[model samples]
Target: MSTTVTPTIKHTALSDFKEITKMRLSLSVVFSSVAGYFLGADTISLKIVLLLALGGYFMVGASNAFNQIIEKDLDALMHRTKNRPVASGRMTVNTAFLIACVFTILGIGILYSINAQTAMFGAISIFLYTSVYTPLKTKTPLSVFVGAIPGAIPFMLGWVAATDNFGIEPGTLFALQFFWQFPHFWAIGWFLFEDYKRGGFFMLPTGKQDKGTAVQIILYTVWTILVSIVPVFGVTGQLKLSIVAAIIVLSLGLVMLYYAIQLYKKMTEKAAKQLMLSSVLYITLIQIVYVIDKFIR
Candidate 1:
């Protein structure tokens, strides 16, 4: 006799969690956290590292989820974002909200297990990113500046989680990431200006893609390079970078600046895309350099 068997259906809700949180973006955030943790801890603990990664992912995921919820309408209007789960009707706003709440609470709890200061910073990051920066994106270009504060927090949050205090070391990490975001994001803004315009998002400080904006991008790129190399002087306390590492990092920065200048000279979509790609390479390489220098020094 053959017996009939039925397979249990997996709920779609599980899939929605991954989609809404932008798991890839959350992973990138966690990478920075892990890097900071390694740099801050003399002896790395796997448990602390795991906790930091989990807490960082939850906080960043919650922020991304809430961002999608608030920008659902605007997202629907942009080709790049039109298919987002919330914007595309794959998930309801109520479902997104619940997920965001759960992620935020879980993230804070995990960080609190590490340290109260880390938990506090994690909460602040979510609140600022979701409540202030996300809405401000449509209102003014300064929103990027507002967003940078929360965006830069993760790198330093790991330090605080490991050490349970805010000091010169974490401050340097924060400044480095904070300055880096301007060029990285403005390159993206330049390339996606039309799409952002369609969504009523003011990403460029000049409101239009012009020489002024390009010049600002170049200026920030220079500033990012300066701050990134400062650790070479051995003045940033625990955040010191060796001479060789500084040279390698500076070279990377100059290459990124070259792309930024190219974009500025042409002010075309293709050039902007190149600049954006270069910016990504710049941030990633510098972070890796910092990690390598920490171990080799």
Candidate 2:
């Protein structure tokens, strides 16, 4: 009985840690950084890739942990987030704070070993996320814009880690992600508007699922698609994309655009959910295409 209980308790603790870190989301963020690293690196070094992935994960985890700590009560109010470790009362604030601190220290330290610039960007991302974005969630719809800064950093952060420089190439990578997030998040905000409202979050541009919000989503989705193909125009420095890759990327964007249009025309929860999932697939596939094109070209 004692042995079984001990194992169960340990398992629960492990699960709580995963929840606090938002492990799946953190891994996805790390994937962006790794892809950027590959794109920017002249010669791939497994050591740098490993360092970037680990440090990137730690930084994203710290931001999520801090966000949970800050929004514990608000999270409890929302049905979607109510079961979170902190919001559910299964994890104490102090424990979560300790984990956040450890992650922050280790993350920055590891990134610093890569380059001062990489560490600086990582620190900025965490600061913006936990300090500005978390607080502004309930205040203004502009919070999404502010949040996009940190959210867009991982891809560029990889380029910086690989090259130790901030240039047109990394900037292009940053712009592509920055624009993509608006439509992705707006789609989510559309479908989950009520759940977010329960938590006092005003995520949509119009604060309601209206034509005004749908138009902005469509506009930003177009902007994202355009930025994704700009590399083919030979204007984005070292970030050149082959014509074939650009066409594939354009096709992927069109698929997302179709869903965005469906949401606008239908204005139903189902359409919004479809757009949300399509946006996820779009970003993931676009990143993969960019990396593969670089290596094969």
Candidate 3:
């Protein structure tokens, strides 16, 4: 229940906190929210952007902290997670809880200062991740479906933060990310099947890297690409993309689809990893293209 490290290596303790927060993942999540902000913003303010980054990081960090706390013992059983702060006994569970509390309070408070709606969604994401998704991971493969709810919120949360309204525009942004998550997560689950099983977590839809799983990934990849290009046709509200931007976005989707199809054809860990990497690139570049096209138009 107590940390073994002496006070001489205080920096190590700080690093533990950063690890506990999953800083890289949290930062990446914030980037998506920021992209959403840019898409919806009429006039950008440095202050708001900074706040969105800070508040979003805090919310995601809080969620990660709580997740690590709950998964501490399970994490220790998995090679990839064995060295994490809580799992390795570098940080006491009480210390992690304290950090989670501080992050949660500051995160929601900052968003509340921005707008009540943003604060509400921020709270919802935290609640869903920690309470529902975390516990359900080991219990059912359906956890991915449940997890996608909170996962998709950050993208739309930014739009709501900017406009203070939750409507078709925000829903469209939510839908794009919602569908994209299926392939992205399934690819990781497919590649990391053994690691996740070691921790008693089965996240893949079919619970194995079989044709059923690969087919689902391809279908979702197609769904993700189609939803992304829909805005180009001006079918969705206020999310119109120029013809050139549409072409670029479609090309990116094709690259992602190519990888997904490869994964389906080979059903190999190597192909799954390739799909995972391409999904990361596809989501990030698509967001960038959208922002650039927004300004171009």
**In candidate 3, what are the lDDT values of residues 155-273, reduced to their tens digit?**
88888888888987788889889999999999999888999999999899999989999899999999998888888777778777888998998999999999999998999999999
In the range 120-232, model 1's lDDT, one tens digit per residue, is: 99999999999999999999999999999998998888889878889988998999889888888887888888899999999998998899999999999999899889888
For candidate 2, which ten residues in a row score worst on lDDT? 2-11
> lDDT at 77 for candidate 3?
95
Residue pairs clashing in model 3 are: none
Tens-place lDDT per residue, model 2, 1-297, is 355434333338888899899999999999999999999999999999999999999999999999999999999999999888999899999999999999999999999999999999999999999999999999999999999999999999999999999999999999999999899999999999999999999999999999999999999999999999999999988888999999999999999999999999999989999999999999999999999999898
Deviation of model 3 at 22, angstroms: 0.6
What residue pairs clash in candidate 2, if any at all? none
| Number of the predicted model whose TM-score against the real structure is largest | 2
Which sequence of candidate numbers ranks them by lDDT, best first?
2, 3, 1
Per-residue lDDT value at 1 in model 3:
100
Model 3 Cα shift for residue 1 (angstroms): 42
Q: Please, what's the RMSD in Å of model 3? A: 4.7
Q: After aligning candidate 1 to the native by TM-score, how far in Å is the CA of 94 from where it should be?
A: 1.1
RMSD of 1: 6.0
Each prediction's whole-model lDDT (CA): 0.90, 0.95, 0.91
lDDT of 3: 0.91
Task: Give the Å shift of residue 116 in candidate 2.
Answer: 0.6
lDDT of 2: 0.95
